[model samples]
Target: MKTRITLLALLTAWHAQGQTLTENSMADSKDIERIVVTGSRIVESIDEVPATITIINRQQIEKQLKVSPELQTILATLVPGLAPSTGTSSNSSQTLRGRSPLVMIDGVPQSTPLRNGALGIRTIDPNSIERIEVIKGATSIYGNGAAGGIINYITKKAHADSKFNGQVSLSSRFSTAKFEDSTGQRIEGMINGQLNNFSYVASASFEENGLQKDAEGDVIGLKYGLSDAVMHNYFTKFGYQFNDDISMQLVINHYQSEQDSNLVDVVGSVNSGEKTYAIKAPAGTDAPGEPQGPNNQNVMLKYTDQALFDNTQLVLDAYAQKVKNTFFYSPVLANPEQGYDGGQSVIKSDKKGLRATFNSLFEWDDLEATIIYGIDALNDVTSQPMVDGRVWVPEMDMENVAGFLQSKWLIQEDLIVKAGVRRENIDLAVQDYKTLRLCKSVDICSIPMAVKGDTLNYSATTYNVGVRYNIAEYFQPFANYSQGSDISDIGRLLRTATVSDIADIQTQASIIDNYEIGFTSVVDNLRMEFSAYRSTSELGTTNKYDPATGVYMPVRAPQEIYGYEALAHYQLADNFDITATYAWVEGKDTKNDIYLGAKQISAPKGSININWSPNELSSMSLTYLYVGNRKRFDTVAGEHVGDKGPINSYHLVNFSGQYQLNRDWQAFIGIENLFNQDYYPAKSQAYTYSGYNVKGLGTTVNLGVQYQF
Candidate 1:
């Protein structure tokens, strides 16, 4: 604690001395080139975007790196409507505006779900990131699964300078808050070079993380039960400039992690009757509980090109990715009968797939346009080896192929129209195998369930038409309509199929539509954006397990949700800045008696965030999040129990600063949760799992140093 205070004191003195130094030059308007993304398939400034967006640059990340213990936590607190909570390896999903948002590296899509490793999104090392761009509204250019918006992590590329540059950094964190202590170490290195018409860049990072505890000193396992793990990432890119109007580039990236096993604790009945919470052995478990390990790997490749013809320019790009997931757990059925001779064994699942996409951009006339169309095709192949547990047949393959097109038209300097459409087809096939009890000289029982090679075709035409009119030099009004869809996991309930039934197999996917409108304005250093929206989800097949048959059945109803968000930011001056935002959501079951529906899984409203940075002497951020009360059924028969009532709303306060000891080096310090407020995240599992929901981490402190040459 004293070390932090001393660092702050020194920072104050250093800033005082620097006050006499000339301030960093502000970027010229022309020099600040417009930033564009696949979001629209066309280039445009942040202000020209009709959808809500929050741009977090390298500078912001660097500032946070000096204070925050983890980059993931920093994102949740900084971005409005982006609430990233702690995950149990398998729960590392990110929700944008109350819906699961898609994450991409450059333009490579990531395939992560329940069957994959539990590493949270935070697993990506922030040290290698060049910038993080977040689009807060729905997007059509990115295709399926982008209903909640998208987050693009753009990594560092080879610099255009004709000189070689290299950098190496090492850092560590010893303690967070007074209670939740943690230790971490990281090594990062990068090299950039440019010569003639060619340029190349390569970077790698390796980090080891120690277990983290909460304010109450309870060990919260974000990476499973094992507290320590290691992750490595590598990136390389080569670009060639053929002529003044032509260029080509190729890029490769990879990430891997080694982690300890994670286990979920299920205790005995806490309440009475059928509504009680009991640690019942999963359909085939031997004992009361079991352990599971999570592991994953990702690799991506891309090719890009640029050309100029006449008065118009063209750009083309392509990307591909391969992902593999392995999960290890103890099966329940193998040990169901206690006192049985056979002991417990582990069950394994392997899921792997690939994705590819291509896009293009063009400009000419008084109208600048961006047209993007691509396809996403991937396969999920999994295996389950019986180990005394509920032994089920292995080898399942599921594939989905989608083709889409989106275009943007700039009719005038301030008027633009965008539209998109996509058609998708999914094929699922599985083989059934029966176990013969050789000792009995016959087959005891056979589970004749499998996907009999059937294909489900789905098509959705989603379009957004909006106008952004500059009402004045400082204000703009905008509005648009957007739609999204969800590819239901129908194979989970298709257990009655056989090779002969291939022709009779049937499946359906869910589609979600959203209508939105709002206005934004920027004057001097103040900026404000607000939008209202309504969204709906047509449930295709919601699966639930049947204890009697040891099978899963699909529900016959759909769901809907509606919400709105308002955000504001102000740079009071070169010496100070402040930001604030709010969101409200109303989720409901449009077809069933169930009050919570699937929507209950997300938060129900009320969140505020504010940040203050004065002259760099010190900066602080504070946030308050509120989740409304809700209920969910315990079983197909039992009434909903212990509805996670309006979980307590809590506050988080953080402060950070840096002190320059010399012109080239500086020391940094910061404190999180200054008030030590206690609360639970919107992702807390108390709503269904065990009655005891997990609590958010409390206050923490960080100290570090950096030397720039």
Candidate 2:
């Protein structure tokens, strides 16, 4: 309690000092300029929004890419209140604000909510992205599957500096602990130009990853891992300016990643927390197949007209996407009736959508306001099937229509209020299918069951309201209330349904309500921000592993969650700057009165980053991250019974630097886990049911060179 009071007092004093500085040095100091588009459909200054928003510019993205090409790792280091990476292509245990956030490339959704593939974060390449925008808390601005927030990856745009311009780059990566057979390579090329009324940008890249090792010089297990893989990415964008008020653009992106592993998992003892291994299985053993990763293709077309009417704007967008993700082969049971020894399943999804929006400005008396209205239409089809063409989860089709209205009122020069509401209607149709059953022997067998198909309809209404007061150029305070809704594991429910009608399945959509209050201040060379939020759901979803079926089942219950975040940035000298951030979160299942595990509630975490620029030709950065202690369970009557017992604290350090040899040539190098810290990730430590705890990677280095023409 004393610590809390001291922190609050310091914050208040800082705000007062900032206000005084702004008043005295208004003409000398310049405020930072940042534009964002995720919180609202239109581009606006970040300070104008009544929410917590984080932006990663091109320079930051490139610097981080030099260290690691994994998007999950980059986001985990930068975004507050987000869980750490799972050291794989799948983000099974990572969550934003204690819930799943919708991942999007440009303006198109990449997540398969119906089946929950947990592969959306790896759908795009980091080299092709120009910027990333993250909005925190519940929001329904972009429609379904945003129960937590939104992550938007903006692609590169054409450069108008010259008629033709391009760059070529190459990099090599290797593990310092064990160098043999642990080397990887990457190559990338890009071109952009603008001629007359037409502009175009194109990029392509390929990467090869080798085996990973731990600090003890032991090869990490290959089961459901990301090492020993090949990745390919291609992206292109074209734009045409027909007139001053009219314009159109088209974008296309394709990405694929496949794994090649020659070993299988060897389970370890659960009581000792010993290391796991990957050993060569028997000759006839069923091993994982090649190309066991995500494959995605996305395309979009957009048109905008600014002169549709007086002081009015019109924008239209059409998009389509196809995604498929393959899982590792599992030898759960042997079945002779279906002519199959084991099962390998894949989840496939196809989506198409259209969005139309109109914005208008109005002025009456001493009041000024802007109104935005839009409509969304979409169709989605998803299914899961095995390698031998057997149905695991029947195909499901859905059609949705939605409309929304949002308005912002500038009541005074220093006060603004905003409100919005949306209505959604959806229809889903499914066909009759049969479930798979395997029998290792007559004593151990699963009975094949028949499932009936039906059509279901659902409707929901969501709303948001907020107010922001700008006290000065250096201080702003805001408060808001928002709502988000999403369908909960529709495919899983359908596959396990025993009734004939869809209504009798006992599954319903989840609606989450969020309330937040925050403040932002900028004074001289320092910037600070703090926010507190609470989110609740009348019917929450909980996942548990069923040992009998070897599958995870979802249960519904009431939930309550809350968290807080604080960030500070300061310029220590002319050539040095530092940033510090802290986040804390907690969640509880109200019905059962049991605290949620690490999967839902991440430990309190913090980070500090230092950047130094001795000259315009060279720069360096060093970062340190710390995850605090987390203990959610205790011994009950001499028996260990909670989710996973407890998890210990850990720390990591990383460094990267760049030197410009000349105007047209440059070199860079990066080191990860600089101290060779031996630790386990929270996901591995808390997952007791799996009986295998994976260790984090050891020290690694990457070196690269670039040539511009």
Candidate 3:
């Protein structure tokens, strides 16, 4: 840390900076090859985009995988505005710029818009991904769930070098603080190759973890924990080129992760300043209903024609997905009169969709324009039910049709303009049902109500416009205004209904407006991008705490959220580089004049990475992350409640090294929490709910080796 600090200070004092420093759509010639297809839904250069986007290449993906297998940690370390990892299997409360971003895989939406479980982020394994593209800010290009933006995972394809090629890898992991029973193993293998007009790629991976302990050698809480977990993933892809003008591709992936621990929660109340931990269950204790986090599957097929017509391209996509996310057993689901102690529930969703697009290009003497038009149709069936044949949330069927048009113009190859419009028509149907009776205390229970269900209709037209100007070599600025149309957590609203008729319930749509302005700069050795944004919505979807029943009810109000993000990278030498990112966000209830809690927002975050490549055969990187404090609401009776607890800051340092032993062999190792800082994660510190105050992982190590055929 000191060496890099000294280098940066000396370089600044001597004014030795040179080259390029940029963070934004238009970076430099080095990144021109980075074609972004998310924000625009078509093949286009980054410079043509009038928004902030982050692209994570394959090399960067593999490097971060060595440090931590979890994609959550990797994304938080790299993406500035994304919330920190929750250190659990669940990604709840980890918002992107104070809102949930739509997660997708190769343009297939992975998020369940009606009932978001926040498990979409982990639906696919890292080995199956070639890259990740993030489009920041509100957008309706993809429709429905993209309230905050989009995160699209681009999958891998077959390599063209050989007819048949394969690789195998194995890894070992254990807690550095206490390795007695805290050990794990992972095995992965993949084969990919090209054969004339046909190409294919397939991979399989499995990992099992033992006990996970903290710095003080205590097992973390079993609720949403990773201890004693087993995960499996299978992925396959096939491609055929009928001709140069036409081609087809198919992709399928299945991922499953579940924990079957022999330990149980040693339950402690966060409100009373006690910490929650886990210990071995009693000898005669029985297991829960089922192991949590069952499985997710995705299948996609695509047909594309490069020369469908003169100066026009055509693409068609068909996709289907299934997800079963089983949650932990909770007393909040208990009903005394029903002779139930606690129950477990699972959120299951089956989704199918089709999309068609056409891109037409036109060029003139001093201007070039591209027009993209598309149509999308989707059907989603989702429900949440208790494992013991009890209905918590009835099944909901939703169908949607959307039409969109996007236009891009480049004037003199320096000034770019973009505009788009999307029209969404949706219908949701549900049968007559009764809300389940839930109890927080024996005497305090929620009354069940039988509600009449009917088909609900919603329609919206959203628009976006942006412009960018490359005025000079050192300054590139962009500004944008956009809107997102969404039906936020409709399933929750229906499940907790108090009225006898669904129509009487507040089923208002959430229309969010977002405005952003940012600039990128490149000067010698420094490249930087900074932006500021503000978002507002008349009908908010913030959750209101119901102390009587321990339920979070939907509350409507006006909300305003604003934030800033900055990304910078400096090259100290030809072989050494230092990159840094910082993000700060704040939100408020515009109607109530009170700041939002951790449930809706997170504290500021900053990260730094120092990379060194000593030679062609060896490389190493050290990463540092800092989460600042956020104190909003005060405690009641000297005890914090809900997510209103104050958050204390924490620091993390990680180390990763890779070396090529031979032409076909390579070794890698990573050390997480290198300093053994015994601290609670940001979510754990601010979430005062039971079983949520688990400590962050201690010093952990991952060592692995790979071999190629």
Candidate 4:
């Protein structure tokens, strides 16, 4: 209660004094000029969009890269409703708005819906990103797999002002608790130039990571952890301006990260209150083969024409992506005749797609109107197989064709109404495959039968409508209704199938409906936004443990989720600024009369950021993040046996600063967990009994230097 009151008072004070600030202040002018692309198919200013959207500009991205190059950490701090990072290479437990969101790079879909490898979010390196755009709530504007929202990672573009420009950066990271073998280094270089009507940009980076430790100077668990890895990234973009009204561009990116470790995990007993897990050197002399990370390659070709006709615009894009991810070796009882003790698994996905859009604008009397229409076509093939040539998940092929239309109407100078609809057709083909049946202690076991080859088809029509009223320069009220559709955990379903054909399996798509009401206020040097939303799905999907099979299976049930968010940014003085964000979310399974599991729902969270720039040569920032207490299930017989147990509140503080030494050189440093607080992550607490639980990172420091010419 006290924290809430303090935050409210701060906001109120800013609102009362904002009018006294200079009307032509540079900070105020910069706030309202930012443009975003994810809100709609076309680029529009932030104030023109009637939805909840957040933009992480280039300056913010650079600041975060100095600390950590991981996208998970950067987004967790910038976005309001996103879950915290798990200190691992996998993002299985992290969700957006209580659901999985579709991730994209330059408007090209990167998520493999057929067989989600959970590697989409880490496909591209942070150095290549120009900015990040997050569109909140359920939206289907860009096709399927957007039940929650969309995160678009826009890549860097060429610099047209210079004939040749280059930047070189080097960074070093080490653990502050114990610095022995916990040191990592990275080097990156980028060059951009423009000549005549053509422009090009190219970049390359290489990094090597070291061991990770906890607060107690103990080695953290290495099972699916982010330690001792090697990463490489290559990117290039080329563009040509055919004329004043026509343009063409091509983009290519290649990213690879692998984990190589000489140690194995030492399992700990959670029932006995033993939380520390250690790692020991392996016995065998076998080499730690290829690293356990994703190898991603992407290419895109885009063409745009502003004068297709008189008052019309056209955009066409074609893209292809290939991703392969490998997992660490796990204990799997295999037949001696196969000549293997244990095996590893790999998931490979290939996608190709084309998209085209047309926009037209016109005016009639006192009203201005605009129309947008587009078509998308895509084909995807994905498979999961063991290293020894055994199929864990058979190859699945999917094809999708979709079309959409949207219209916007402006009434005088106060109101704007927008409406849109989309239709999607999807076809999936699967082949017959056998399931793995491993026995314990050489005992005979009954193997589940394989599912036969079959074809499945599905179709859905999603719609959205919204209205925004510009009451005054300081306030704007809006209401929106949106819808989304997705196939929940298709990979899990296919890998654990016991049916003979596709018809016997439950492959129905889940449709989500979302309703939202919100308002935005821009008063001088202060900006604020608040929104409330409710989303429901008739056939929502949740995971349940199958004790008999020792696996998790997806179950369909009626589910509803509601949430609210508030954000404020105030310029306290000419050299100081503060920003605050808060989010509250709750979800329940209506059919079962129980709350959703932690994997599907996250607790309330808030963050505060302060920036101080006393002069132009140096700047500093401090950030505080808080996760509230959450308890969802009742104790039965003195045992906590439920999908979600109990979670305690935790907070963290971080500080970073940058200094410019001369015209050609600069230096920066970041200190994470400044106070060195020892606490378990919310996800780990929710899954305490699970073997996958692990502790969060302790105090760490990252310092870097850069040279530009």
Candidate 5:
């Protein structure tokens, strides 16, 4: 009773601060401020870039965190052209611009491209991030695994101006419909400061989640679930300035999240209209397997010289990463003859890389140009093996070497042109292995075949060109064409091989060609942007269901994908503003003349945001999201096959607020699904696989307080 009363009291006080509005609380200008962007592998002005990039700063991140601590929620809420989150531990259904994107931290890659376990998005906790930069187009800027673009997380740095600075935060989460066992808690702390030429920052965080319940007060399904989960993260960075022109920095991070559920999944069939859910288990209903999640570790060292040779800038980065992801147990791994009823699999990867870049600046009368050239070398070893001593995919050792040159030119201070080219060479080696003989029943099983493995080689050259015209303050136009390659996902192909000779395997490097055109307009208190894009590849990356084997078989076919996106923002009053965004995408297999399934495409999505800041001490925001229906596949004999089920529309509303109660304390609250809407997420509705048609989160509330020192 006291806790509820205290929460109401805090809410009342926070609401009172916004009861009256004044002109002093309004913004003074309509000018759209610009920030530096690192999407091009260099810090450049936003207006100078020819593509759409979303930059979420620290203030924006903090505001969003008040509503949900999950990184998937934040990405779905802020990024356009990205699929909605699956509301689970896996991101297999989430793609950027109808394709998979490469995730990175401080320019170091975190994704396991060799096999793509789809667990890269949650490698690090959101609290350790200083900002998120998203580039929404294809290019060879950093190398392969960027066929859809790049999502880079920049880490926090020390407060060099102060001797010591720190912050501590505590928060709680619970379901509004029922709070019996649906509660969670989080604790986090960070410290940073500077001494002489040395600066350092460090942080630690921990969280434990209780059971998850739906709007109907039923426990959510346990497949890929987050119930009864525990997480821990540690991060640190140190820097030393040798002189005014040279410096070095070192960074280390470790993160782990695993679900140890007490409730078991009550599997349901989608065709029968039975939704999957969970319940309190009877005696010994718990499944056999290790907890499902990821364990990731990353280390990086950087050296910078601003005055290299007195005319160029030099930056060198060396990084290493180790990753492991475990999936839930299933009967698909049953091999009765081999003394194994069922088992689970784990994907393990290790990567080490080095990058060296040189930037040169030139100015001649009215033309100013910048040239950037670099070389990247990396080695990655990845494999998938069953927990019960069996190899599903043999270990693959890959070595990649690449060189790139990019340049930007500004002519007459009104026209900008950018171009770049990259050359890549990759080699993969695998030993001989045999395919798993998975059985659906005692009498029915897949044929086991001995496969031959040898070294494979691939080489490609990609190019990009673009132009941006600053015609006037009210209008700007841009156009660009770029190229990138899809590499290292061949592990899926090797595992499903039907041939015995390594030379007869039908596979090749998938070269991607991307084209884009867009424009931005800023008039008075309104700003708008629109862009259209098209991407094509020789081999499509998609999988089809094999009912006999209970497996998803990979399909290689020619593909074409196209999409469009729009954004608009208007300031209604000095203290109020509104923004809207929309995205639509479609894809088809050129060879078969059939629409691609949900695995590679997403339904139309839109969102509107209303922000109000009555004073510096208080702020409030309300957001609305809408997903439209999309049906591209016809049912075969009244059964939706594979991942091509029909998708239905849904709506959601969210609210967030924060108030400064005192000089050293702050209180905040966030409510997701404010109206407690009952619906299925897009991915849940599009996949007919068992134990997948789960409900989205209901009315969930988050409350927290922070102290600054």
Candidate 6:
């Protein structure tokens, strides 16, 4: 209660002073006064939008350069509703506002839900991004699997005004004895040019990861185990001015990663025994561990604003992604008695998808209404090799199609109405296969005797509605009711078997319904927003895995969650600026007899962040975050189980700053977890209890130099 009052008072004082919050201040002046993309169909001021959206501009990214890695390292520090769980190895994933939100880069979907040790989240480098847009809460505008929210990474676009401009920067780091070559470096370069009616922008970046160790100089379990990887990112964009009334842009983005690690079998024994000894043999090694040798590529073609009608704008986007994994797996250690094999295995897959949108705005009855509609299609194929590098399962494919319609109505100068709906259709198909009894030594296995149906179909529809009103000058108050759906990628994979009929297969749909009220205020030298919300999803869709068929069944019930978020910025006098944000959330299953989603992770219940910049040449920040305890059915590897109530709240602080030594040279220093808080954000219990637990880095310090031209 005290915290709430203090925040309210601060907000009232700031707004009462008369400062206008500029909705599109983050963008350059020529871009647009107000713009809306993923949340609503119409282009409106951020203050007038019914949903909550956070925009991180280029300036913010520049400020964070002296901080930790932008991908998963500093998630909890910047975004309010997002918290990083275990993100070691390749399986690191984040929970948004307490739920999993889908991430997209230039509309290319990127997620690795089931793949063990998959580095899906580290596919992009921050240097290639121009702006980061986040829509908090359920999202139906993009269609399919936006139950929590959406994080869109917009890449840099070619500028027409610049005839030729280029930027280059080099950075390095200082390390302790924990890392063999504590020294590492990053190089980035970008160029933009415009000739006549054609304009283009291209950039490239290369960065290497440093090692982390414990106080004793020994490795700290799986914490940052795969932190020694290297990243390479390249982006290019070209825009053509067909005529005064029409123009189109094409963008292509690509990134490649090469990660090699020797921490295979790092899962030492908790109980001493011969069974605890690590396997020594190469192919027959039964060491319960995995090595890394993986890479991926993405290519996309986007045609923006192709003028079909004088007043209508259309955008067409298409892309394909291919990811390959060649790693070592020890199946014998998984099930000693029924060991399949122990050797190197490779899993390779390809995904392709396309989305197109049409937008139109016109005056009707002295009122302005903007309408947006679009369609999306996706297809994925998988092919895997056995432990001996022999082809096992033939190629399998899954496909999806969706269509959506959304609109924004400007009822009054200060009042706005928004609504939208989407329909998604999915199909899964597999090649004919027959199984026949054969000896285990045979490299090639017989195909299934019977052929399964060609296709399995699943369909669903989702919708949302909301309103925003400018109650006071520079103050916009809004209320919204939004809905979204979560369709399991694994659930759709089940229909490929020959035994099930498309009609009998039931599609599980998790529904998100949200109720929220918030206000955005801008005051001279101060900007802030405060919001409270209640969101719930029907429980029937909780993940329920069936052992008999090895399928995740959907359980229906009611799951409720509620929370609040507050953000504020204050610029005191000449150069002192401070930014802060606070957030909280609580989630529960209301109708489950037994805690079905017991081990389900919840969003953090409390968080605070403070950034201070005394001048352009120097800056620093401090942040605190707390992850509430959750109730689970059984204890997980010594970790408390049952109504665990709440895990002890942990607080962490990070510091960073930069100093300009000369006109073209600068230095940076950053420290993470200054107090060295020891805690775990994510853990799992498998086998005798084996899973990644993010061991907090006691205190890590890095210093680097940057030179620009």
Which candidate ranks first by TM-score, i.e. highest? 3
lDDT of 3: 0.84
Candidate 6 is scored at a TM of: 0.80
Tell me the tens digit of each residue's lDDT in model 2 across 1-709: 2332233223222111211111222332222126565676765557668889888777778877888898988888888877887667877667888888889987689988888877888988998888888899988888878877898897876665456899998999889988977799999989988787777888999999887777776667665576678999999888777776677888899999987767677765334657675656678875555458889999988887765787667778899999989876655534667667776788899999999988776766556677889999999899988766778888989898999998877665567788999998888888877766765444555555676777788789999999888888588999999998788468877665545565677667788999999999999999999999999998777765454555455667888999999999999898899989999998999999978876677778898988899999999989898887778876455533324546788999989999999999999998888898887777666665443377778888999999898
Better of 1 and 6 by lDDT: 6
- Candidate 1 residue 85 Cα shift, in angstroms, is 1.3
- Candidate 1: Cα lDDT at 287: 31
> Which structure is stronger by TM-score: 2 or 3?
3
* Candidates, ranked, TM-score: 3, 5, 4, 2, 6, 1
lDDT of each: 0.51, 0.78, 0.84, 0.78, 0.81, 0.57
Ranked by TM-score, the better of candidates 1 and 2 is 2
What local lDDT does model 3 show for residue 684?
A: 88
Error of 4 at 47 (Å): 1.1
Clashes of each: 12, 0, 9, 0, 0, 20
| 100: Cα error in model 5, Å | 0.4
Candidate 6 per-residue C-alpha lDDT over 1-709 given as tens digits, one digit per residue, 9 for 90 to 100: 2332233223222111111112322234423323434465333456557878877666556555555554665445567766543435343335566556666776566653222233445666777776677788877676555556777776665454567877776776433435554455677888876788777778998877655443333344432344455767888777666664345556666676544444434454212111111112366443333444455677777555534575566667778877766554543212223344444455566878888877776666536676788888888776554544343344557687889998877764567888888887876665554322122233332222343435656676877888888776568888888887665343223322234343343434566887888888877878788888877877434454343433333455687777888888787756556667777666666785444232334434454555666667776666555655543445446543222323335566667777877777877777766666655443322112232332444466767776654
Best by lDDT: 3
Which segments of candidate 4 are over 4 A away from where they belong? 1-33, 269-271, 276-278, 283-290, 332-342, 438-446, 634-643, 688-690
Better of 1 and 3 by lDDT: 3
**Higher-TM-score candidate of 3 and 5:** 3
lDDT of 4 by residue, 1-709 (tens): 2332233223222111211112332234254236566667775556667788889887878877776778987888778988776667777657788877889998898877677766778888888887899988888898877878899998876665677998999989888877878899999999987787777889999988877777766666765667788899999988877876677888899999988877666655333445645565656654343568888899999888766887777888899999899877765435444555566788888999999988777777667677889999999888888877878888888899999998877677468888999998999888877766643224543266677878789899999999999889798999999999787467767777777786788878889998899999999999999999999998887777555654556778988988999999999899999999998888999999889877778878899989898798998888888889889877655655434667788898888899999988999998877877777777766764444556677788888999999
Q: Give the root-mean-square deviation of each candidate in angstroms.
A: 9.5, 7.3, 7.2, 7.0, 8.3, 7.9
